[model samples]
Target: MNRFRQFMSGRYGFDQFSQGLVILSLVISLIGTLTRSNILITVSYIPFIYAIYRILSKDINKRMKENYQYTMFINTVKGKFLKGKRNVTGTKTHKYYTCPKCKTTIRVPRGKGKICITCPKCRTEFIKRT
Candidate 1:
């Protein structure tokens, strides 16, 4: 028992949060699978499998976080415009760009071409070369 505790403590010391997420996802997945619900299965299983792979595989966690954040950011931006809702009056249609330096996504009004922009997170300036 002591050896098992020591091994777990060492192997997953700082990974408890991720481990918990993985376990929770797995439980959801199992429930979905048992109930044979397609949507629930996809919602619960896919991310659970991915999280497990990300946690146990050779992929770096930072890279996983970046990839997840980028995907989520893109999804959020896409959802906003695709929902058939217009922005507040006086707000122009905006084009969004992800900062190469700090990964901060910025939105600028459309038709602004060949401009330089600075990222708030990294404070790095780069041309919008679009």
Candidate 2:
């Protein structure tokens, strides 16, 4: 145990990006197995190998940057999905409109008859029936 600890003392270690890579590798491997595709099975080893490389890498700063970028990308995707979900859920009670000048999305209450909508971003005025 002491020898193993010493071996890993300066390693970059496992992180979220590594975990994601491992999961991706596993999924690809499973698909390859189900389809019995040699090419896919060979490709599946790429991510697993990269993950192992990351875990054993001594470049802590570079690994941290890579993990940060991966997390940022994931957060951006999640934010977009959540925003879409909120828009969908609010569709029953609100109307969404885009500003003609700035293309900003404005949400207004539903059932308002022939209302003049103002865009908060670009101060554009438009008339719409909700």
Candidate 3:
């Protein structure tokens, strides 16, 4: 146990990307098993193998960079989805709209019908009903 721990001491053992990879691999493996699909079984090993390689990798800097990139991409997509959901189910106190000129998001108080909106970033004027 001490030897194993020592071996893993400086390793890039886990990160969010690695965890995601593990989950994806497991899901693919399980689906392949359930459906008895040889192709999925083969596909599942790709992530599993890469994950194992990442865990055991000794190049700390490269691993950290890759992990950072993966997390940033995930966060970008997740943020957009969450932002869309928030826009769809806007709070009763405020309404959301996109600025037509600069495409910036504009939030205004609700129940103010037929209001003129000015883009704070681009200084473009538009009319909307809130």
Candidate 4:
């Protein structure tokens, strides 16, 4: 155990993306096993190869950068999804519109009838029905 730990000390360790790859590969392998499909099992080897390559890689800096970029991309997608969900669910009590001049998203309380809205960034005023 000590020897194994010492050997891996300088190698790139696991990250979220690596874990995800491992899990996805496992799921695919399981599906292939349960269904007795050779092609799916072959396809599942792709992520495992990448994950193993990352684990054995000695270039720690590059691996960390790759993980960081992946995490940031996932976070950006999650943020967009959450924002859209909120917009859809808040229609009962709130209204969302884009400023025509600057295309900025603006949220206003609902049931105020026709209201005048002024853009704080572009200073463009427009009338909107909420």
The root-mean-square deviation over C-alpha atoms between each candidate and the true structure, in angstroms, is 10.0, 1.9, 1.8, 1.9
Please, what is the TM-score per model? 0.32, 0.85, 0.87, 0.86
**lDDT ranking, best first:** 2, 4, 3, 1
Off by over 4 Å in 1: 1-92
Estimate, for each residue in 67-99, the C-alpha lDDT of model 2 and write its tens digit.
999999999999989879989999999988889
The deviation in Å at residue 53 for candidate 4 is: 1.4
Q: Regarding TM-score, does 3 or 4 come out ahead?
A: 3
Clashing pairs in 1: none
Comparing 2 with 3 on lDDT, the higher-scoring candidate is 2
Candidate 4, residue 75: CA error in Å? 1.2
The C-alpha stretches of model 2 lying farther than 4 A from their native spots are: none
* Alpha-carbon runs more than 4 Å astray in model 4: 30-36
Give the local distance difference test score of model 4: 0.93
- CA lDDT of 17 in candidate 1? 41
C-alpha lDDT of residue 126 in model 4: 98
- Please give the lDDT score for candidate 2: 0.96
Worst 10 residues of 4 by lDDT: 13-22
In model 2, the worst 10-residue window by lDDT is 95-104
- Poorly placed runs, candidate 3 (over 4 Å): 91-93
Best by lDDT: 2
Clash totals for all candidate models: 0, 0, 0, 0
